[model samples]
Target: MRPIQNGITDAEVVFTNPQLNQWVAPMNGNSRIRKREGTNQNAGGCRLAVDSAGHKLDHIIFQGGEDVAVSEGKHVIDVTNGYLYGNMMLGRMGLEADEGFCDNVADYGTLSTYAVNTTDIKLLYYWRALYTGINRANLLLRSIDNPDVSISQLERNHVKGQALFLRGYFYFLLVNKFGGVPLLLTPSQSSSNDAMQQPRATTKEIYVQVLSDMEQAAGLVKDIRSVESAGRVNKSAVYGVLARVCLYMAGYPLKDVTKYADAASWAKKVIDLNYHKLASSYRQVFINYAQDLYNAEESILEVEFYGNGTGVYNTTGGAVGIVSGIRYFNTAGSYGYSSGFVRPTQWLYDLYETGDLRRDWAIPPYRYVGEVITN
Candidate 1:
């Protein structure tokens, strides 16, 4: 509860802290879980002890619930950033066994199905990261309404809206990849075996929950465009995501064609808001992304990254350039470090007719220093 009141980001709470980080480590490996016998014996940090009447001793950590709500609100940006990038988004799309790949094509070939095996660490990490967001959101929802909390109605609405959006967004990602997963609305008290083995929900039930959360979020999130930070979700972005969810619902598997109407209506709402539009030059969009120039008239959302020349690699630090840029020595001057991990297919190139401005823009012109490489 001290950790919760202090408002650590979901990642820190799950990975950095001593108590929760144990859940991530395996039980029987060389890296055994440290005994909790003396975990809290050393009192370097302050502790918050409240009597039944609700009197707190630690002033630093036990700030009022309003402050906690504000801290929880900040997690929305970090959670969105985590979801927008990472292996789940890039690997899923990039790993297909396509002739476009210069290397590791076989890894992503039919063999790639093993990448999603239940025991796979990377895939499991994706699931955990999403559930971390969901848990934090649930905690926020539960705590925001406490009688001791003193947030204004507007702040309460904003926090609730952001939490709902994150929960819905994460659930949408899960259902798309793994189909129905256990719908855990309450935060798990401990990572017990029983908690880990909850049964799966139906695909329909999952989507219903996602839609309900997002719809409620839309009603509460207002003035998002004026937030002074483009990284934050606004009303337009909520509607945009809702539209995307609806489009997915209308597709195969479920094939509920009625969702097409919902998709169109939500998309029309985004367009009607006039929050974003087509950039004059399609190529400039990537250029703007490289320069971190968000809030372009054409930009709806952009995941951000930062580099500090750290000795260790930070996945969420936005190192995508190391993956998808121009390959073999960065000839194209693209920031993705041009790993050439993914190349363009000739069929993809042929799809565009002459005078199609986006064809060359979308596909890199690979001139690899005197070699005419054919894939």
Candidate 2:
């Protein structure tokens, strides 16, 4: 099979590199049976393709759980690092810096700093990216039971569980952002206007579906201990997210007070599992994130971003530190560079008590002047 190109017409190739090409086998009628390749691999780097025949089906189905996991993994990063990060910057939680007021970050900052309408390009991108994620999950869920797919029942459940969780998670993000959106559960099979247009579901209705998807997912996915990487979602992650979802449902829009109890129940389930605990130090948590270390005990789920934009998989790296981290500049490479697009507000900093270690790590009191650190 030939390596797919960027902006390929027939396939949704998220990432294409030499490393991905080694394991991401293309699906054709001749080779319908395939096994997932590699353990603890970067699933975000996997690519998905649609053959000429399958392209007409309106969705691409992978041959194995690994393929689904790989494709979904990229979506996970897009949602967390892309959409969710934008949400943080837009909200009062993070103040957008002047540097962020230009270029790509400006698209998002404009929505917050100025009066913007639904027609904003950034909003459109966010909507499309999220729905794309939901559609991938939907396709996986629809294809898991096909006999043509060679995955075992166990493998099927694993992927299905992740898909359900992801679909629900995508919808959760959507409902939080847009209040109500057109809810599409099945994979798109037609390009007709009738098939394309969907009425917006009610906020309560969306929450109900989210709850169903996550609750079912919690049962199907593997335990956190069994998962090799924090990048992959497991039972604990599902439970934790479910708890947060319940809390949202119990709040302003829905005002479903009963969900508070549900939230507590889900939160308690994670505690009962005994797999996760607070790290030794508050700084270690963020340090683990910066260093790309997996400490499942504290970090339940994370979007894995690696490399330095130099290797074959140049797209593997993310802007987590560069955008929100401290600003520094030096040509010697002794001090890393950060645009510092988002900074903590004084109110947020003051929320921390004098002795709080998180105060310093989260919102440092110092700045870098050339090669020297200064306060």
Q: What are the RMSD figures for all models against the true structure? A: 9.8, 8.3
* Candidate 1 global TM-score: 0.72
Q: Write the per-residue lDDT of candidate 2 for residues 56-134, one digit (tens) a residue.
A: 3333344334434333322322343334432332232124432223223454556546655766766665666667667
Clash tally, candidates in order: 4, 0
Strongest candidate by TM-score = 2
Assess candidate 2 and give its lDDT: 0.56
Cα error, candidate 1, residue 51 (Å): 11
For candidate 1, write residues 193-288 as lDDT tens digits: 332589989999999999999999888775546543334456776888899999999996789999999999998998888667786688777676
What is the C-alpha local distance difference test score of each model? 0.52, 0.56
Q: Candidate 1 vs. truth: CA RMSD?
A: 9.8
Candidate 2, residue 69: the lDDT equals: 35
